[model samples]
Target: MSSPGPRSSVSPSGRSWRDRRLDRDGSLGLRLTLAAVAAFLVLVPFALLAVLVVGSWTPLHELDAAVTAALHRFAADHPGWVRVMKAWTHVFSPGPLRVAALAVVVWVWRRGSRRLALWVVTTMAVGGALGALLKLLVGRDRPELLDPVARAAGFSFPSGHALNATLAAGVLLLVFLPFARGRPGGRLLLWTVAVLLVGVTGLSRVALGVHWASDVLGGWLLGGAVVAATAAAFRTWREQAGLPAGRTTVDGVAPELVDPHA
Candidate 1:
């Protein structure tokens, strides 16, 4: 019998095209990619609002007014839910966030990743400052068609709670994702919680009748910008310090499993 034909080599770890691309590029590349997307989200939405939506846009303004008024009235009509929402909303406010920030910083430091801890703190600080500055520039009035159910003082173009919550949650998740590398469904769960936190916090402002819907949307976009920039910076700094760039492998997948070439 003729000898068996040569058998093709199998990777032993069934990798895919995406895996190979990620492995070749690694962590810094991934961060930079995300940063590009985030920058687009940040600039585009804000510019659209500043140039088109804020003025010379009667229909959009009407929509914002309708939604804001509806939510405010709905919450007021439901006394029980209003109370719960108010309490839940505070968790994202400055008072509660101060404690949460302290806890996260301490935990990261104790875990021996001072760079990550510092990244969290600084990202939040800078994002908050930017939010404040943007609010000043927009100088949009709060929705006063309904009585405000919560105390607030500021120009309302962008909701500070929404912006701050997005930044804080995004930074925390990105920084700690490496730890979830091997845990099943860990990244999904983290993302779910983060998105929920951001969504609810933004809605809470509308629920209280203190912010228009557009304000929350702007905050969300702005927060995305901050998260992307800080994440990119964090990884970049590691490379500068001579630390090996983290592999692009996520959720503990071995490079070979995802990289077809491997």
Candidate 2:
């Protein structure tokens, strides 16, 4: 009789050897678990904040009032500071962030990573749209400060500036982090800049007396949830395509971008 055929290497589930290795390593499971946990943590607070804002919770309202009043007073006294914040907010506003993301999308698309480019566009578009819808649904008003140093129009539970800043920061960090792979300092600097941009942009919205602290906080939480959710989805797609499950915190969302021939 003919020799038995070589033993099949494929798993019972039809996964290849590489996929079986990935399953044994548990990297994909860990990544998805972390992303789910992150999303849950952020969304819970955001939901609480929304509920409180809608219910007009006394303590939260009082805190918002106090913070807004304090910031307004400071803005009223410091003309230079107000001017700087205005410039900073404008530079990081939704319009500019969209333009920057568009540039990145174009670059990546040209580089043949159409899916990565599409991911960027979808994340930004969905985040912005959802934020706008939440504002309308919440029907929360912007902080009405006496002698306001800056003005913003529309419902303001989530500060548009803060949300857009956060979306932009996450998008840019994930897109560019691949280039900083081997350089620890470069990675640190990238993370530092992203954090500062998100933090200060939110703070500026409050300091300008256009958004309450809670509004900025809500923006941040929602924006973070969107990024985490999208990153998790992208990682799953990569795994299905037989690509490495690169960690977003280290290897970024698209490690293949670092390959010149890719």
Candidate 3:
């Protein structure tokens, strides 16, 4: 009798590892849900592109109307708002923003998966290149603005800096989600900081006269699509490779060593 000796009291060394595949009953539903969302994100961009293509015939005339309205309003009142808008240009300044982003990534690298770091670099680099190619094809001219703060050399239909910012922010989020395991509060804080930095960079481009509002918007759409596609690819790769999805790393130290999500 002896109270059955606390059946299987010891947990297995790899007990934290969980299977990522859906169970039989849930598989169909999960697959369908993912497919629907994937199709939506993919198709939305093409629809937006269609609008831009049709609008190109009168882009300059449209731009003139918009800029004139804005200037007339600014001339009447709210000079401070104009200055504030101009100040936003600082966000797109290449040097300081780049350093700040890199600092966040380095700070997050406690147990540091080199693969994750590589993915971040690849996402940004490929997104930037593709954006540049598209800009060349569109060959859109920059907006005409008086006393612009900085000069941008690239064709201006879609801002490359804005595109890169969105991709870098989004890919980092996906790469970090699987690794996050500590108090929910800390995870939320980190994500908020990352998002704000990306948003500010994109906004800065418009304020500085380096890109139009539409250019920044297009960059966000294109960059976000690339990021989502990359994340989906990574999910498939991890599944095929049979790596642990949400488990703390066991190859080096015990789960308790690095505070789970740090």
Candidate ranking under TM-score, highest first, comes to: 2, 1, 3
- What TM-score goes with each of the models? 0.75, 0.86, 0.63
What TM-score does candidate 2 get on C-alpha atoms? 0.86
Top candidate when judged by lDDT against the true structure: 2
Please write out the lDDT profile of model 3 over residues 94-187, one tens digit for every residue. Answer: 3444464465456545555545555566666677777878888778887665654456676886777777767666755554544355557656
Residue 138 displacement (Å), model 1: 1.5
Cα RMSD, model 2: 5.2
Q: What's model 2's lDDT at 60? A: 96
**For candidate 1, lDDT tens digit of each residue in 1-262?**
8999887864725756455434524553454555556567666776787654457488778989899778877887898878877887887885576567768889767766677678778878888889888778777877666356776777987788888888877766665556666675887888788889899988888887878888888888888777767766665566545554555224221112222233
Candidate with more favorable, higher lDDT: 2 or 3: 2
Better of 1 and 3 by lDDT: 1
Candidate 3 weakest lDDT stretch, 10 residues: 248-257
- CA lDDT scores, all candidates in order: 0.71, 0.88, 0.58
The TM-score between candidate 1 and the true structure equals: 0.75
Clashing pairs in 3: none
Question: How many backbone clashes are present in model 2?
Answer: 0
| Candidate 2: tens digits of C-alpha lDDT, residues 181-225 | 999999999999999999999999999998989999999988988
- How high is the lDDT of residue 27 in model 2? 51
